[model samples]
Target: MKNLMKVIDALLDGLKRVLVRFREAKLGLLFIINIFKIPDFISDKRVNIINKFRLIFALTIAIIYIVSGIDFIPEIIVGIFGFIDDMFVLVWSLGIVNEEIEKYKKIIKKNKDPKIIEDVDFHIRD
Candidate 1:
């Protein structure tokens, strides 16, 4: 019975990791899609119009997943599930930074503005 319990515990641990990875992927995709919608990168006024509506929907899901601790599978049952949530946030944060860098690069390329480019790099360094 003890050995059986050990096996069950191990399986639960693995399951938690898998579920967390699933959540992280969902969050990451949403973030990447949003990055393309930023005003500077997108010229079409229509694009902005579409994205504003999309943003609301995306933000709603993001808020629920982040602010509400209710997981599809309860975190208490599999401890690592919460860690997965943290990982998702970490990845999403990194994606935001990356998107900002790309945005600045585009700005620098378009205007050939040394001051703006320098300012962007300065913030990136700090």
Candidate 2:
């Protein structure tokens, strides 16, 4: 009876981990989609070679996700391999999105009006 209980507990733990990984992957995909939709990110003036490469890479990964199917390792077994693949893709996509966001933020910050800065500085000193 004790061994059966232990087995049940292990299965539950595995299920929880898989669910968490799935959720993370979904969030990562959403982030990538949002990045692709950003007008500034896709604009001719703002879209550099790196941004283009990142976009292409993300699309390719998404295509793979669709073609390979979510159950790469056979969902019945609940193997860690498939989950690991998803987690890897999620991390890679997140990294790419983060890099692009940082680049965009820097550009926007640099291009901010000098008058805006002067006004803020004057107000802060007062």
Clash totals for all candidate models: 0, 0
lDDT string for model 2 (1-126, tens) is 999999989967765765664555455555556565456666746558778678668757855874676654654477655576565555555555555655666777777654655534334553
The most accurate candidate by TM-score is 2
Off by over 4 Å in 2: 1-37, 70-81, 113-126
**Residue 1 of candidate 1: its Cα lDDT?**
100
Cα lDDT tens digits, model 1, 9-124, are 99678657655545544545655664655555345332334444444444456566767777655578887775676445444444443444344455555666445445343335
TM accuracy, model 1: 0.35
Model 1 misplacement above 4 A: 1-63, 112-126
Please list all clashing residue pairs in model 2, or write none if there are none.
Answer: none
Q: For all the candidates, what are their Cα RMSDs to the real structure? A: 12.2, 9.6
**Clashes, model 2:** 0
Worst 10 residues of 1 by lDDT: 41-50
